[model samples]
Target: MQNEPLAYRMRPQTIDEIAGQQHVIGKDTALYKMIMNGHVPSMLLYGDPGVGKTSLAFAIAGTTKLPFIALNATKAGKKDVEDVVADARISGKVILFLDEIHRFNKLQQDTLLPHVENGSIILIGATTENPFHDVNPAIRSRCGEIKQLKRLTTEDVDVLLKRALEDPDKGLGKTPIKITDDQRLKIADASNGDARKALTLLESTVFASFEENGVTVVENGTLDSLIDRVGVFGDKKGSHFYNLLSALQKSVRGSDTDAALYYLAHLLENGDLVAVSRRLLVMSYEDIGLANPAAGPQVLAAIQSAERLGLPEARIPLANAVVLMCLSEKSNSAYVALDKAISSIHSGKTGEIPSHLKDTHYSGAKELGHGGYVYPHDHKIGTFGGWVNQTYLPDNLIGTRFYDPIDAGEEKRLSAIYNKLEKFKKEK
Candidate 1:
């Protein structure tokens, strides 16, 4: 026990000893009750590393007094899972803790389906990635419960730190170390809500302090070295990535510049340039179309700039585009118009094209009554040569209005000209 790392030594022996995750493991909660009753179903424990997934599994096995078989899915093969299943068959029941379960392929995961479906093995699959995307659907469906453990809060980290300092059997109580509340919080902040990481850093800092000053006091300078590195908290292929991208796009569409910038910072921090550029480009046309015609072009230019400049520097141009998109007069008129037109066609309202509007450049087209097409340029009205009131849509959809522009931004001036054209056609 003394040779084990501080994190391992400080593993919670019971559910009551587990810190954080009160929502799932608190008293009277379903999970808590399940463990207390010793009837835990097959479950997938998912979250960022060191937030007590393995600890929770151990706690459940301890409470249930079931034979706990631990195996890392990253390196474990079908044989390893089969061995556990075989043991469960002999022993009646077994709790198998498979860590990094996402690393297992479909074949490796399928090996446990039969045992899991039977009462042979109660599988507790743990992963940092989202189970829905990374785990096989068959394996996931068999796991009756999927609980997400969130990052540890500052308060939770504090509890762990204090417990470690005082626990004689499993922690640094023998070292007589002293850590201030502020210093403990700084360590927690640097840990990024990982309990294992926090305990590891605390243990290392204590050793460093003793080695340097021959004392057990951790100084601010000692911690500064360990916490300087940035810990990015996101999996690009997981749900966190999509959720952030959705927030960024929605913020821009809703014209909330500050919120857009906030989410953009997170994307840039995560090095998701492609998602940032793609989502911003979509926002330019989908949310700001026609209302601010220049917005789409400006966003395209920004995307090009970002692609050329690449990260760190790319955030500048992307930020500019995001601000412009959020501040621009917003409209979805063109998008809505296209959808309405498509709906009409899909609903079988598409009538035959006017014979005059059909191509007359082909041979015999004129003889087929595809002639006398009205040329709007021959009767140009405005300085730039506007069109006549000849029908461009199908005859049945002649009076159907689709592109209804709101009186916002550039659409206001265009709407005035459109109203004028309608009045002229009425008079004629």
Candidate 2:
């Protein structure tokens, strides 16, 4: 135990000892009562990395005094699952803790369904992704409940740090290490609510400080060095990645330039340029389409520039694009119209193309009545108008208008031209 990493050594042995996540494990909660009764149900634990999902699973095992079996979905195969199920069937009381459950494929997940349903094994699946999007719905249905663990607050992280410093058995309590309250808080803030990361940072800093002078007192400089090495509060591949991306896009959609830039910086700092570029491109079309016709092209150009320049230089163009996207007139008419049209198609709202709209360039087309197509150029009216009314859609969709332009950006001008076209066709 003394040789183990501080994070692992300091893992809480009971639910009450776990930090944060009171919403799920607090006394008097259904989950608490369930654990206390030793009637642990199969559950899915969802949250960002390092917020104590695994710890909670261990705590539950301790509370029930059941045999705990741990497996990582990333490495565990169908055979391993079968073995666990076999053991559970004989043992009668086994807790199967599967980490990174999102990595389990359909077949792998299905392997556990029978065992879970028959109550041979109590399964605790943990994942950082949204279970709805990542988990097999069949497996998800079998899980008695899905509980989300919230990110730890600064105060919660501080408590863990203090406990680590004072625990003589599993922590640095044997060492004469001294960390100021401000230093501890700084480390907690730097950890970004991840207790494992905070403890690891503290452990590493203590070693470094002790090595320097034989006295373990972490100074500001030593703490700063460790914090820099640990990077930021959130993992780029975890839920934080999607959350920040969502916030960035929403900020841009809401026309909050400051917020947009702030989220942009967060992504850029995390070195996720490709995701940032892809999202910006999407926003150009989905959120700002037809509002500023130039927005789409301008964003494309910015992405191209960023790709060519890279890094600090790339950020300039990306920043410019983010600002422009936020400030541009917003419109989702095109996106909404496309979806509406697709929905109609999916609902069997389609019909054969009008004869005149069929291909006329092919052989024997005239015999098929394809040559009767009217040319607008032949009916020229004004400088811009060789206008003529014609059946451009299927017979059933002839009058089914889908593109409704919003009265914002260049769409307003487009709406006038469309209204005029409608009037001309009506008159004819």
Q: lDDT per prediction?
A: 0.86, 0.89
Pairs with backbone N, CA or C atoms under 3 Å apart (clashes), candidate 2: none
Pairs with steric clashes in candidate 1? none
Superposed model 2: Cα runs more than 4 Å off: 77-91, 104-113, 210-215, 232-243, 362-364, 372-374, 377-386
What TM-score do all the candidates reach, one by one?
Answer: 0.87, 0.89
Regions of model 1 farther than 4 Å from truth: 210-214, 340-351, 381-385, 395-404, 414-428
Report how far residue 215 has shifted in candidate 2, in Å. 5.8
Scored by lDDT, model 1 comes in at 0.86
Q: Which lDDT tens digits does candidate 1 get at residues 316-374?
A: 89889999988899889989989998998899889989887888887999788887777
Q: Give each model's clash number.
A: 0, 0
Shift in Å, residue 199, candidate 1: 2.8
